[model samples]
Target: MLTTTTSKINIQVRRFTIFDIENLYTYLTHLSPETKKRFGPHKFDKQSIFDFYRESDKNIGYITLDNENHSIIGYFIIKRGFLAHDRERLEGYRLTLDNQTDCTFAPSLADHWQGSGVGKLVFQFILSDLKKMKFSRIILWGGVQSDNTRAVNYYINLGFKTLGQFSHNGNNLDMIYSIDQSTGKTDGGFDQ
Candidate 1:
């Protein structure tokens, strides 16, 4: 369990479970259109979320909950390997990624908590968890949209290196973050 002083909210991250269905539903459904437009890895409806929970092993889900209100404030997923599209796009950089040492990451925070520093806190927890799980790097699941300056800056600040750009549902930037165990520092810079 971890706490966020910046957000002024007592929160803890844990594996998502079946019990979280109702709260998770509320969280997903309530996302503003703008938020939804930026985060569309899958359907955000109740049935889709339920289906995701049922197939949790395919991609591990984590939820950050507010201790006081017990509502989910953040959600993330870690897939053990890269998606086919991601792999193909990354190959354009002439860098082959190893499935054993690399994984894919996707993260989303509640609308109200979007710029509250809570995302950074939760991300730190995620990095630690990934290291423990033996993953040495992470590729953004469905590259970030180029126009989302806030998210792009967050990734760059966290040391995610931009590999290239590709047009998907929109203009997207492919990025990768190598986990450095020695100093927990990343090779920071933008490739584009």
Candidate 2:
């Protein structure tokens, strides 16, 4: 678990639980339309929530919450080689799939929490967890929309390289991040 305080309000990072479904659902349900657009393709279906709860070789979820309120402020998922469209594009990069280290990353934060430095915090926390898990690669889920410059830029700023482009549900940019395990090195361009 990771805990941080912003102006005295504590925020924490932790794995999801069966009981968290309601809070997670509430957060997804309350996501602004604009938030959905950038992060869309992500839906609030309760079944999807259950699927995440299942946690298998295919999908996993993580979350950040205000410790006092227990409200989800950030949510992220990593899915295995399930998106056929993603696998086809990733194969071009020669990424080894169907393993522990290779997966797709999809993260979304509450609208108000975005651009407020919460993202970097969550990422730092997640990256460390990934390192401990010995993961070496992470891909953007569904690819990123060609037009969402902020999200694209955010990924790039974090050391992700644009791998290619494909039109699945829309024009998306396939990107990848390769981690150097021995040294725990990354772009680390953003401050911790």
Candidate 3:
């Protein structure tokens, strides 16, 4: 299991292992609609999610934030150094280099935790782990429906910049964002 320091709230961030895949599956399957649209169609059942750990080239890490009751209040996944081709929305922005690394996030929490600073804590943990993994840069592409102002603002606040807008379905266009880890800046005003 991976362990991370928590804030004064006493939330602990720990890495998920093969044994924890089932729990992770449960978490992912029940995420909010906004999160599902951004990172879903996970394309795997419980066994497949577990099998991924056996692959030598993949780096999968999950951090679960537990509350005083020992119940998981939040979680995040980080896949190191690979271009995710399954996400059709990112077709134009896909990384060309084999060495490029990208990150995606899915947070599962009740509405109460939305702006309680839980995301910042989880993100900071992911960033620290990425640095230790020796990745020079990381990109996170989030799709926001034009009307989803809350999500667009959330990603921007987290330091992701909008590269441009692209249509996902015939009716909704997604705002693409990119972040440069080297400078910790985004193309849009998200970094500020």
Candidate 4:
């Protein structure tokens, strides 16, 4: 578990549990249309969310909550392996995919907390955890919309590299991040 404070409120991040279903559902249900459009790896409906948890044996969900009210402020999914679509797209770009060392990452923050620095804190903890788990790289799940400047900049600021681009509803860019296990730091020029 990771804990920190932002805007004077204590926040905690940990793996999702059965107890978090309702709270998580509330959070997902309340996401704005823009957010939903940017993050559509899975359905946000109650049943779809529940089905994802039940059927996703290789995916892990992490939730960030506020200590004051225990409301979910962020949610992230770390997939153990790439999906067929992602693999195909990556292969077309000549980028190698290693199931043992590469995983898919997707993170979303509450609309209210979008630019409050909460996302960076949660991401740092995840980077460290992934390194410790022996993962050497991470790919952005479903890639990111080329026009989502904020997200594109955020990923670049976090050491992700643009491996290639593809069209998905609109133009999308596939990004990859290499984890330097030796120093527990991300290896890439995006941050430089």
| Best TM-score among the predictions, by candidate number | 4
How does model 3 score by TM-score? 0.67
Residue pairs in steric clash, candidate 1? Answer: none
What's model 1's lDDT at 122? 74
- The collision pairs in model 3 are 2-15
Instruction: Tell me the TM-score of each prediction against the true structure.
Output: 0.88, 0.84, 0.67, 0.91
For residues 127-148, what per-residue lDDT tens digits would candidate 2 score against the true structure? 7767777777887887898888
Error of 3 at 92 (Å): 4.9
The local distance difference test score of each candidate is: 0.79, 0.75, 0.53, 0.83
C-alpha lDDT of residue 34 in model 4: 95
Candidate 1 per-residue C-alpha lDDT over 79-168 given as tens digits, one digit per residue, 9 for 90 to 100: 887887777678888877887788988889988888777777777878877877778889999889999988998899888999899997
Q: Itemize residue pairs with steric clashes in candidate 4.
A: none
Report per-prediction Cα RMSD to one decimal: 5.2, 3.4, 5.9, 4.2
Candidate with better lDDT, 3 vs 4: 4
Query: Largest lDDT belongs to which candidate?
Result: 4
Where model 3 places Cα greater than 4 Å from the true spot, the runs are 1-8, 29-35, 41-45, 55-57, 84-111, 141-146, 170-192
The worst-scoring run of ten residues by lDDT in candidate 3 lies at: 183-192
CA lDDT for candidate 4: 0.83
Task: Report how far residue 187 has shifted in candidate 2, in Å.
Answer: 14
lDDT, model 2: 0.75
- How many clashes show up in model 4? 0
Error of 1 at 25 (Å): 0.8
